[model samples]
Target: MRVVHLLRKYNPAEWGGTETAIQRLFEGLRQHRVTSVTYAPSIGSSIAADPLTEAGFAVKRFRACVPVWGISTERKRQLIAVGGNLMSFDLIARLLREPNVALMHTHTLGRLGGIALTSARLRRIPSVVTIHGGFLDLPESMTNNFRNAHRGGLEWGKLFGALLRSRRLLKDADAVVTCNRKEAALLKEKQTCKRIVVQPHGVPTSLYRKDHRESAREAFPSIRDQRLLLAVGRIDPVKNQRWLVEQASGIFRRHPDAMLGLAGACTDEAYGESLKRKIDELGLRQRVFLTGGLPPGDPRLIGLFQSAEVIVLPSVSETFGLVILEAWAAGTTVISSRTSGALDLIQHGENGLLFDLGAPETLHQAVDCALLHPELKSRLAATGGRVASAEYDVTVLAGRMKYLYDQLIAEKNALRNSAG
Candidate 1:
C-alpha cells in the first residue's frame, strides 16, 4: 500500500514530540513493507537540515517560513497564516496529483489539516489525521492579537476562522487517531468524526538495553560521578522546564550530589535564554547541564537513560510522552507529571512515581524519594521494564498500526466499490 505521512517538519535535529512520533511511525510502516512517503517543509539555509532518508521512501519538500526571522510571537502568527493559505491551495493540489497515493496520514491539524482535507476531497484519497495536542483548546492569551488587529484581519474572527476550518478538516477525515484516551475523549467531545483510534507511540527496546550503560558513560565523562537526573524535550513554556528547575533546587538542597541533565534543542531562543538565566539566578549553573541535540544512536543518549537515578517529565500538557516508555525500557524508573498520557502507562508507586504538574514541591519530594529508596527504584524499574517490553515495544506497536491501516484501507475500498 502507498502511504504518505504529512508533517510540519521531519528533521530529527529539531527534536519535538511530533517529529519523534512521525519518525517512529515511518520506521514502523517500513518494517511492514509498505511504501511510505514523507512531505515536509524545506530546511532552508539555516543550520537545521532535513534528515529524511532516501533508501526507504520518497521525500517531498514544501517551502514554508519557519524557524526563520526567529520563531517569535509575531513570526509564529505570520507563519500560521501563510501556512494555512499556501497549504490549503498549493500544497493540497500537489499532493492530490501524486499517483498511487492511497492514504495520507497527517500528524497535525492546523494548516496541514486544511491541506489534508482539500486533498481528500479533490482526489477521493482516504486520509487520517492524528491529534498530537489540543490546539483548539489553547488558552486565549496565546492567540495572535496583533495580527487580528491588522487590516485584512478578521480580528476575533481569525481565531474562530482557524478553529472552524480545523473542525471542518477533522469532520472530513476518513479516520481520526489520537495518542491516548484523554485526547480521544476530547476529540469526540469537540468534533464529529466517523472513526477514532487510540494508538500510543512506541520505542525501540534494542536501542536501550542493559549492556549499553558502560559504553554510554564512557562517551560522556561528566556524568560518571554525578547522580544524574535526566529530562528530554523541547525547552519551551508548555514543557514547564522552569518547574523542573525549581524542583531540582529543592532536590539539590537535600542531596547536593545530584545533578540534572537536559537533552533536546530549544524551540524558542528567548525561552532557552530565560531558562539559562533562571539556572544562573538559582545558583544551579554548576549542577544543571543542557546538552544541545544528540543523535538517536549516540551512546551518551543511552547512557544518560541507563545511568540516571530517575527520568522526570514535568510537562503541563502532553498527549503522549514517548520518553517515559523509552526510559522504562532501559530499566530506569520514571517520575512524570500526572497530566501527561504517560499517566495511563505508569502506575504511581507501582511502576513509577507520579506528581501533580502544578506542584513543584511534590515533584521534588518524588525525586528525593526515588533517590533515597534504592529498592523502590529497582522494583519500579524492573516492573516498568517488563511492562514496556511486553506492551510498548516498537515491533508490537508496528503490528497494531499495520492492522489499523489495513482495516482503514479495506473500509475505504469497500465504500468506493459500493458507490460505484
Candidate 2:
C-alpha cells in the first residue's frame, strides 16, 4: 500500500518529535510492504529536499511564498519562535494528480492537511490524520498563543479558509490518531470523527540496543564520564529546558561531576536565547551543554541514551513521551515530569520515576535518587527495557497500524460497492 504524508515543512536541521515518530512509523510500515510519499512546503525557493530523498523516501515539495505560503530561511527562525508557518492552496493540485496515492496520512494540521483530506475523499481513498503533537495537552496559555484561531493559513486564505478550514481534517478523516489517550478522549468530545485511535509514538528498540557508545562519546565527550543527565526536545517554552538549567545548581552541589545535556533544535529562538542567558547567569557554562538539534535516529542520540546514568525529561506538557521508551531501549534509568505521557508510560519507582513539574526540587530529588541509588536505577532500567522491547517497539506498533489501515480500506471499499 502507498500512503501520502502531508506536513507544513520538513528539514532535518529543524527536526522534532513529530518528524522522528513519522520516520519510525514509516520504518514499521515498510515491514508491512507499505511505502510513503512526503509532501511539504518549500522554504521560499529552497526545499532542502535532499535529506528526505537521500534517506530513501519519495518527496514532493510544493513552492510557497513568505508570510503566506512560506517563510524565508531567515524568517523561518522567527516563525519557529512564534509557532505559525503557512502553506499555499496551490498544493491541492499536487494532491489531485499525486500518483498511486492509495491513502492520505497527515502528521500535521495546516492548509495541506485539509487539501490532502479533500483529495483523498475525491479519490475515494481512506484518510488518516494523527495529532502527533498533542498541543491541547499543553498549558492553556501556550495553546492560546500558538493556536491563535485567527492566525496561520486561515488568516492568509481569508474567505476561502472560512469556506474550508483545516478543522475539516479532524472531522472528515476516516481515522483520527492521537499519541496521547487523554488527547484522544478530548478530541472525541469536541469533534465527531468516524474513528479515533490512540497510537503512541514508537522507536526501533532493537536498533537502539546496539553498541554505539564509542562514536557517541566522540561526538559528545561528556558521555565519557558516564555522569550525563540528558533532556531531548526542541528548546521551546513548553519544553521547560530553562527550568532544567535552573535546577542545575542544586544538582551540581550533589554530584559535581554531573553534566546536563540539552539536545534539540532551537524552535523558539527567543526562548533559546533566554536559556543561554540563564545558563550564563547560573554560571553553568561548563556544566550545562546545549547540543543543537540532531537528526532522527542519529547514532549520537542512541549513544547519549546509552551513556547517560539517567534520562531526564522536563517538558511541561508532553502528551506521549517517546524518550521514555528510548531510555528503556538504552537500558538507562528514566526521570520524567508528571505529565500525561509520563504518567501513562511509567510506573513510579518501578519502571521509571516521575516528578512534579511545578517542583524543581522534586526533579533534583529524582535525579539524585537515580545517581545515588544504583539498585533503583538498575531495577528501573531493567523493567522499562522489558516493556519497551515487548510493547512500544516500532514493529509491534506498526502491526496495529496495518490492521487499522486494512480495516479502514475495507470499509471504504464496502461503501463504494454499496453506492454502485
Candidate 3:
C-alpha cells in the first residue's frame, strides 16, 4: 500500500524527536512492503541532504508560509521553525493531484494536518494523525510559550484553518495516534468517537549494538576521563537545556568527574544564546560541551550515548521521550523529568528514574541515586535494554502499524462495495 506521510517541518540539520521517529518508522514499514512517501514544507536555505530521500524514500517538498502579517521577518522565521501553524495551498493541490494513495498520515496538527485530512476525505481514503508533541496534556508554562510565539502578529490564516476544519482534525481523522497514554486519554475526553492508538516510538537496536566508546573518546578527548551526563534534544526552552545547565553546578559538587554534554541543533537562536550566557555565568565552560545537531544513528552520537553514565532529559514537556528509548538501546541509565512521556515509559526505580519538573531538587536527587550506586546503574541499563529489544523495536512496531493499515483499508473497501 502507498501511504503519504505529511510533515509541517523537516530539516535534517535541525533533527529532533519527530524527525528521528519518522525515519525509524519508515525503516520499519519497508519490511512490511509498504511504499512510503513523505510530504513536507521546503526548508528554504538548508543544503542538508534529505535523509529520507537518501534512504531511498520519495520525499516531496512544497512551499508553505507562516500565514501571519505585521510580524517581523525574524519573528516569522522563528514561528515557522518552532511549530508554526503553517498554511500551504501548494501542499493541498499536490495531495489532490497525487495518484494511488491508500492512506494519508499526518505527523503534525493545525492547518497542515487539516489539509491532509481534508484531502484524504475528498479522495475517500483513510487519514491518520499522530500527535508528536503534547497538546491536551502540555504544562501551563509550555502552553504559554506557544501562545506567546505569535502574540503580536496578525494571524491571517484563521480563515484557512476554518476552511480546512483544522480544529476538528482529531475528530475527523480515521485514526488518531499518540505516543503517550496521557495524551491519548486527554484526546479521548475531547473526541470520544475517535480511534486513539497509543504507540510508543521505536528504536533500531542493531546500530547501537557495537561498542563505539573508543570512537567517542577519540572524537572528543576532553570527555576521556570524565563521567558524561548527556542530554540529547533540541536546544529549546521546552527541551529545558538551560534548566539542565542550572543544575550542573550542584551535580558537579557530588560527582566531580561528571561532565555535561548537550547534543542537538539549536532551533531557537534566542534561547540558544541565553543558554550560552547561563553556562558562562555559572563557570561551567570547562565542564559542559555543546555538540551541535548530531544526525540519528551517527556512530559518534551512538558512541556518546554508550559513553554517558546517565542520559538526562530536563524537558518541560515531552509527549513521548524517544531519547529514553535510544539511551536504553545503547545500554545506559536514564534520569528524566516527570513529563507525560517519561512517566509512561519509566517505572520509576525499575528501568529509569523520573523526577518532577516543579521540584528541581528532585532531579539532582535522582542523578545522585544513579551516580552513587554502580550496581543500580548497571541493573537499570540492562533492564531498559531488554525492554527496548523486546517491546520497542522499530520492526515490531511496524508490523503492528501494518496490521492497522490493512484493517482500515479492508473496512473502507467493504463500505464501498455495500454502497455500490
RMSD of each: 3.9, 2.7, 1.2
* 2 versus 3: better lDDT goes to: 3
Per-residue CA lDDT of candidate 1, range 1-420, in tens? 888878765555656666666667777777887777888766544544444463355788776533222234564544442223223235666787788987888876666666666676667767788877545433344345322434343223234337437547778787888878876786789778888888888887877885667775776667778899999887776677877887678788889888998887776566788899989999988899888877664677777888899999987766678888888888899999886476678889899999986566788788878999999999999998888878876767877877888887788789889999
> Candidate 2: TM-score?
0.93
- The C-alpha TM-scores of every prediction are 0.88, 0.93, 0.98
lDDT for residue 177 in candidate 2, whole number 0-100: 90
- Expressed as tens digits, the lDDT of each residue in 162-277 for candidate 2 is 44567576887899899888888888788788899999888788888788778779998765764899898888887899988999899989898899999899887778999999
Clashes of each: 0, 1, 1
The pairs that clash in candidate 2 are 65-70
* Winner of 2 and 3 under TM-score: 3
Residue 290 Cα positional deviation in candidate 1, in Å, after optimal superposition: 0.2
Q: Give the per-residue Cα lDDT of candidate 2 at 127.
A: 92
The Cα error of candidate 3 at residue 418, in Å, is 1.6
lDDT of 1 at 193: 85
Task: Give the Cα error of residue 264 in candidate 2, in Å.
Answer: 1.4
* Candidate 2 structure lDDT: 0.80
lDDT per residue (tens digit) for residues 326-349 in model 3: 999999999999888888889999
lDDT of each: 0.73, 0.80, 0.90
